[model samples]
Target: MEERHVIVTYRLDHATIHELCAQLEPDLMSAIRHPTGIPPLLQVLSVLHFLASGSFQTTVAIASGMSQPMFSNVLSRVLSALLKHIRSYIVFPQVGDLPAVKGDFDALGHIPNIIGAIDGTHVALVPPSRSEQVYRNRKSYHSMNVQMVCLADQYISHVNAKFPGSVHDAYILRNSSIPYVMGQLQRHRVWLIGGSLYYSPKKVFQIIVACCMLDNLALCRQVPFLQEDGPAGGLVASVEPLDSEEEEVEEEDIDNGNNVIQQYFQ
Candidate 1:
């Protein structure tokens, strides 16, 4: 495929996709070594197509020359493999490293001590077999309430994907590790600013993490899902925000009606 086609179809450039293939190849080889099995690259591409297009399994699987059932198994294996290496990509800035991060944020908007921006978005999820009500956001669709923190250049630094959409944003923030990390500040000026907030199943968690890792990887590689090409060799923007205006949910201040922000600062 040409460069444009590849980016549109897979949301990744060739080099990035090849690097991903390399990373996942070892784990995928055992299945591919079988006579009737699909190649790892094909498996990965199929999943990417499904993700990028939101197409039915039949469409993607047929395009990849596999049955829907087989493709489902492939998707599971690929997602599991990717999740195993999730920690490498979705790293938060270290306590000692906060100064540099703050500097970048300051440069961007003269917002001193602003280490990152935080926001929540709901990613559409398959209806779970159990406790389906909690996954349904006010928009009336099942989703995972994913909290993301982005650095100055829009690279994702931290992701909390364990909450369901029905949970309050304040509740997720209270329960997230960010508050503990903030507690240890004890006078540090670093801040992560945004809006939003699952009890998702194990497989659901893996899928969310894997997607976040991929988003970070694309950002690091200067890949953009946008149709227009960026300046030659210039840094590309981060993945497009998953939350749209239609999907935007008004955040509820769940801390006994007190200002959650003031509570954090005080």
Candidate 2:
């Protein structure tokens, strides 16, 4: 295929495509037939095309020179291989390097002690046979409520996607693993910026900020905002004072050199 064709179809250049195929080939080689089946490169290309375009299996199969069933099987195998190897590529920022995370947020909005931003978004999906009504959201559609935490640079630090669409964002956070982790690491004076849905004075110290404009800017710049669709509804601007207990903790941590505004990524 021509370079332009590769780029448009797979959203990757020829060299990068080849490099990815080479890396994935070892895991896929056993599934390929010697002469009758599709080549490994073609399988990778077909799967990439399907993913990039989000087209139906039948449509993608026609372009890939394979039957729909074969294309589906190939896609599943390729996805399985990628999932098996995903851990090597995706990792959260280390606990020791949190100061850098704070610095990045400070540069963006002068928000102090901000280690990350947290938000929940809905992903549209076909209704499941079981408990279909539970998946219907306020907008009258089925979805999965996915929550994510990311740094200022848009790197995701945590994610939880198990909740149904009808579940409230705050409820998801309250039931999530984040609170336990934060409690264990209470020595750090870190906070996350979130919208009204995540606001709770007693649950944790999440900064409630009007993030619609910042979210739009981040999306345009491809800043990896947690939501796959886009920004949630607009939020009214409001700032609540930090609790007295939190203020004391922050002062102690600052005295101990755990300054949340320390220079990061020097």
Candidate 3:
């Protein structure tokens, strides 16, 4: 395949994709090969294409030399394969790691000790017949509420995708392991920020892990995202708050949070 086509379709170059596939191949390889079986490389490639394109299954499936049913299963398979390797890629900063992360972020916004920026998004899904209401988001579509924590360089440091679409972002943040992981004292500090090809809750989470892993790798490789204008631009966009009151932080906490911001700015 031509380099340009591969880059456009997969959003990763051949060498990087090869490196990713190498790590995933052992888990992806079958015990015994069947004539119809997909290779690990093709499995990863097909899934990457679907994620990069965000097109329907049949379209990508057909292009990948598999049926739609096979594509969904393969999507889950390749994504799940990366779950074991996630910590190696998307890691939360420990005390020793905090200074560098804090430095990068502090330079960007002139806020000291801000280790991460957190945000939430909804991953759309086909409404299921069972307990379907929980999956419908405020926008009235089936989805999963996915939370992410990002560093200034755009590496995804953490992810929480266990909640349903109806759940609020702040609720997911409150209920997430981050508070426990970071210690109660650090909860007020550090903060957040993929792809896909699937809708099952388990698969959705895996997709987040896998895509973030690739995104981190791509960031390391200096692979610009489709929308990123050029070298002088950034791997991540600054988070812009929405006008919706639903997105607002608790009124009681705003005063304290503002104080923190003010203290840093001053």
Model 3 stretches with alpha carbons more than 4 Å out: 31-36, 184-198, 226-266
Q: Give the TM-score of candidate 3.
A: 0.75
Cα lDDT tens digits, model 2, 221-249, are 44322322445423223332222221111
User: What's the CA RMSD for each of the models?
Assistant: 15.4, 19.1, 16.4
Checking candidate 2 for backbone clashes, the offending pairs are: none
Is candidate 1 or 2 superior in TM-score? 1
Worst 10 residues of 1 by lDDT: 245-254
* Cα lDDT for residue 53, candidate 2: 56
User: Could you say which candidate leads in lDDT?
Assistant: 3
After the best TM-score superposition of candidate 3, give how far the Cα of residue 197 lies from its true spot, in angstroms: 7.4
Give the higher-TM-score candidate: 2 or 3.
3
- Candidate 2 stretches greater than 4 Å from native: 1-7, 33-35, 196-266
For candidate 3, the per-residue lDDT at 15 reads 84
Name the candidate that leads on TM-score.
3
lDDT of 3 by residue, 1-266 (tens): 65665677788887888898899999888521544355677778788887776667666766766656666667767777878787788787787777788889888988777778888888765445787999989999778998998888888888888788999887988898887876743644654321133356666667666778888888889876653244532212222111121212233333333343233223
For model 2, what is the alpha-carbon lDDT of residue 21?
73
